[model samples]
Target: MERWLGLARSLVIYHNPATVRAWRRFYGQILRPGDLVIDVGAHVGTRTRAMRRAGARVVALEPQALFARYLRLTLPRDIVLIEAAAGGAETVARMAVSSRHPTVSSLQAAFVDAAPAAPGFGHVRWDRTEEVRMVTLDGLIARHGVPAYVKIDVEGFEIEVLSGLSRPVPMLSVEYLPGFASLTTRVIARLEELGPYRFNPVVGERSGFLWPDWRDGAAAREWLAGLPADAASGDLFARLP
Candidate 1:
């Protein structure tokens, strides 16, 4: 299933890393050799490959059965590409399939609700629907190993995904709904719940970096809380305190 979906949604921006060049740079410090990477939404394994190239043992996690198949084919044999979603437990959830853009398809309504009013809205046509297993970070760690870094881009359900984590991920990243700052607030709180976190955004592909000279975590959150909803379309990188 992972293979078919990757071929179907290769055009989606989420699977294409070209637009997030700056984000890759900002996360440079966290990517290193032998480090374990828990890619929560390992759709197509694009980021999974990146982490591998950057020298990390990636545990690519995806719930969509089709996507999981692709991860197996595309990723190196060493990558423990798992077929399931990351929440809090191993269960099944109804997933929404994209007829237009399969990569953006997600089971969580919050993710679809946070979709931007842009070109990719109808991309995932929702042609098919299915149920996929869901698991948690601690569970993955127990099965594979505790990760040095974890990346979550679960759309609007980012909070629920984060809420499911039972282990401390030293360095992590998650998507933010600029349109729904309330969601962003919850994400920040969740990050803080794990430990100290700082906000840094990258604008316009690889135009440049934007790291405000904030005094502390509070200051950084204050700055992020003020950015316009359309100010950016990226993830918030954080670290454990």
Candidate 2:
């Protein structure tokens, strides 16, 4: 019962109408009808819902049991909800869970270590852990076919998630934190190996990009390094040329 309350709070915060609209506008620019999208770390499926509204076929992945149950109950029949984590390989990984604020739950211990000191994350606490199955992006591609776009928000494990992709898709985005800027650079380095991908930044949940034009990986890395240490977390949008 207590766990349900925490999950409800997360749903309320993330499924707010204005935020949903912002995500819709941003995602609409990238998704098209009949296109396939893989949403790793789908959480409560708010972004999955946004992508569905954009007319894309979505495969949503969530590792946490409680969150997975919430998604299974609310999501429509067409959306594919996978109750497992996405990583560089298939294995059982321990997930540190915050019962009161489930969105901060992560598979990376280092992320948990660094979060309390980071602004906006001081209230989060990982009170417990659960072992969950993990799957690779390439494995998902093999089973579900390659996606047109992949949205990954696996906390500090973004690099591991990207490691699974043997080839680049049309477009993809990974969550980035200024507190963990170096990890974002590692993610960029991984993406560079996959394709000649250009990048842009979308801070927080904003509908607009930071730059008027996409820049190269080196430029993007430099921009990330230049950001203030307190800059809010956001996603790095990358696309293959």
Candidate 3:
């Protein structure tokens, strides 16, 4: 019952017309017709639908059983839905599940360990664990061709996901919690090692970039460092320049 309520909450929060419109507008600006996109941690497929509406062919990955089943039934026939998690390797990993707040469920134990004390996460609970199949980004590229964009939102496991990619895609975005600034810094460093990339951030669920000009990694780090301790979580976007 609680799990279903959590799912309902997510659907209500993310599937509202305003949020959907924002996502469509955001993706439309970055994606061209017939471009390929990969959406990791697809959750309820709201972003997947938005990306598809932008005329991109999408492959969405969701590991949680409930959401995977939900996506399989709801996502359009054209979007490829994969019931697996993206990780540093093509192997199995244990996922921490938050029955009452599924969005915070994660594959990283360290994330589960630290999240309880985080400003906005004190109410989230990882009440159980489940083993899920994992795929590497390199493996996905080999199977699905190079995507024009990849959006990863695997809680604190962004670094592990990047570890699986040998080369950089044209663009990518990873979720960044202000409370987990160190994790995001490592993610930026990893992208820098892969290629020359500029960074920008989209705060909360808004579709617009926070900065007028994309910043280098150093500037990005400084920006992260300067955010208020209670800042809302957002995604850090990186693109080749």
Estimated TM-score for each candidate: 0.81, 0.96, 0.98
Instruction: Give the RMSD in angstroms, all C-alphas superposed, for model 2.
Output: 1.2
Superior by lDDT: candidate 1 or candidate 2: 2
lDDT of each: 0.68, 0.89, 0.93
lDDT of 1 at 11: 37
lDDT of 1: 0.68
- The clash number for model 1 is 19
Residue-level lDDT of model 3, residues 1-241, one tens digit each, is: 9889989988987877778778999999989999999999999988899999999999999999999999888889999999999988899989999998999999988989999898988888888887899999999999999999999999999999999999989999999999899999999999999999999999989888999998999999999999876999999999999
**Candidate 3 or 1, higher TM-score:** 3
Ranking by TM-score: 3, 2, 1
Off by over 4 Å in 2: none
Native-to-model Cα distance after best TM-score fit, residue 10 in candidate 2, in Å = 0.9
Q: For model 1, how does the per-residue alpha-carbon lDDT over 41-102 read when each residue is reduced to its tens digit?
A: 87767667767767788788887766677677767899887788877567888877674566
TM-score-wise, the better of 1 and 2 is 2
Model 3: per-residue Cα lDDT at residue 198: 100
Which candidate has the top score in TM-score? 3
